[model samples]
Target: MFHVGFVCAEYRRRDGDGDDELVGGSGLSRSPSRSRMIKRLESLNTVISSIWWVFGFYWIVVGGQPLLQDAPRLYWLTVVFLAFDVFFVIFCIGMAFVVFLALFCCIPILAIAYAVASTEGASEDTIRSLPKYRYRPATVLSTFNNLGMEEVLGARSGLGNNGSSGELFLHSEDSECCICLSSYVDGAELYTLPCNHHFHCSCISKWLLINATCPLCKFNILKGDTLV
Candidate 1:
């Protein structure tokens, strides 16, 4: 047994010495392939993160303050967005559909419709029109899922902004749930608005089945609601 162990130890030492000699001769203290791979991965991550941040910031800024004063800046930002979209499309073919969206297919159509609807006064038209777009709604999926708008806005909900999970937030305590006849508990389950009302999640889920509106205010839950 001692002889066998001795032979194995000598074999390991010989192998270690050969590795050290090869490394020293090549002057490669670490594996070249690993270093190259890490550098390539880091470069790719930087590009993707930059794309995400630039567009994300533009979306926040313009969407928050949509005014003629910033229109030119917004236009250039849109160009950057388009360029990023092109790169994204190359890498993610599924995202190529966003090109059509960038073309103003849906938003422009809605904008024109809204413009014609309230063309009586331009200032009033601008106020209404701006709000129509300034807010992006939180997406809700399944209708059966009882999660709140915060979850969707936080991007925890898998549904995209334009998808079914769209709704606005309510910031009034005057709103009451008829089922409970009480003011909402902070972080309480609430119904979405323009139909600004509150309800327990369980109560609202059951209520929606029979009637998709707030019982106290008769505000519609399934439609015309904005998520804050």
Candidate 2:
């Protein structure tokens, strides 16, 4: 009776195998997950490329319309402007590509660095021992005060001449103080730095008391001075 039962079980197993094959064997039953992902990526790339092409086409069609008209001056102006726009777009795209490439290349380098740091058992003392790249706030503040003191004294000496501040002068109408974001008024007290940059006397004095460099160009005022 046991032998007969075993034979029946074997027959059932064979019947199940035939049904599995008919439904599609185990090897071919699973979905193509990787192929679906590739399709998705391809579709995304196609959509982006299509949008870029459309934008370029529209720009060319609309931008050249002025050139096709009879106004010669307008045509030349439009041409120049379009040329600059194209150049700017190309430059931005190139910069973005370079940034993307750098990021892609840095991933593996960062992973390796982290792995090495972990394996070597990095400590706080070792990190602190590494060469620092930042400047101390105290040093920056001292330099600012030192540079501002000389200008402040000069402005005071010039103040006695007919109430006109000698350290300040009226600059061009278009000139603006970068620190205060104010346009230069006629006869307003202005301070001109050694770098030929001008600013409001009050605004620059306060700024120099905190930073020794030119606010706009960042030229160091005390770079050349030394203890003789």
Candidate 3:
């Protein structure tokens, strides 16, 4: 009996020791993985910070050198670009604030407006039933008229010699319309802007209607026009 009791005690002690070792092993395994993840996060942060520093240094050198060299036009051009950037950022912030107010305070504003309109004998139903605003086709035509499209087109036509093969031969073989990515095809109608850059008639016409500039080079097509 004494021998059997001693054997049982030894078995229980061994089991307790085994359980403690298993718990310790698990903790040890998890600690290494946790430390590795932390190290990875720290490395990523360092890389991002380094990239920003390089970008800032580059811009400072590029933007500051013109001023140091006494080039007033380039300096002022950079300053104007920065000023426009500031205005653009402010405009974006203002737009976001307006959208937030519209989303949250819309019901209150609409209610107040409706109450005032109703007092002035305008019915709520009539206000709700009003048609949504849309841009007119004449707006595009008016913009073209303002840009003096006729004079610009006539000048462009006179500059480039008409190719008899229906394919416009560009001076450079590397020439490709930046818009469509395709090389000017044989039998395709093309228009050469004053900048000497050529594009398909349909592509340049659509683009010029929106903005009057060479797409490849941003030379203003209306720069020489006194009426523009």
The best candidate by lDDT is 2
TM-score order of candidates, best first?
A: 3, 2, 1
The lDDT values for all models are 0.49, 0.56, 0.55
1: Cα error in model 2, Å:
57
| Candidate 2 lDDT by residue in tens digits, 53-162 | 56765765686665456566866765576678779899999999988987888877897787544333223332222221111122333336756756654554455333
Against the true structure, what is each candidate's TM-score? 0.22, 0.26, 0.26
In candidate 3, list every pair of residues with a backbone clash.
none
Decoy 1 TM-score against native: 0.22
Q: For candidate 1, write residues 127-184 as lDDT tens digits.
A: 2221111122222342224564456444522332233332333334344557767655
lDDT score of residue 173 within candidate 2: 47
lDDT of 3 by residue, 2-48 (tens): 33554565565556556768877434444455556545665676687
- Candidate 3 runs further than 4 Å off: 1-167, 225-228
Model 3 vs truth, CA RMSD: 31.6
Q: Give residue 188's lDDT in candidate 3 (0 to 100).
A: 57
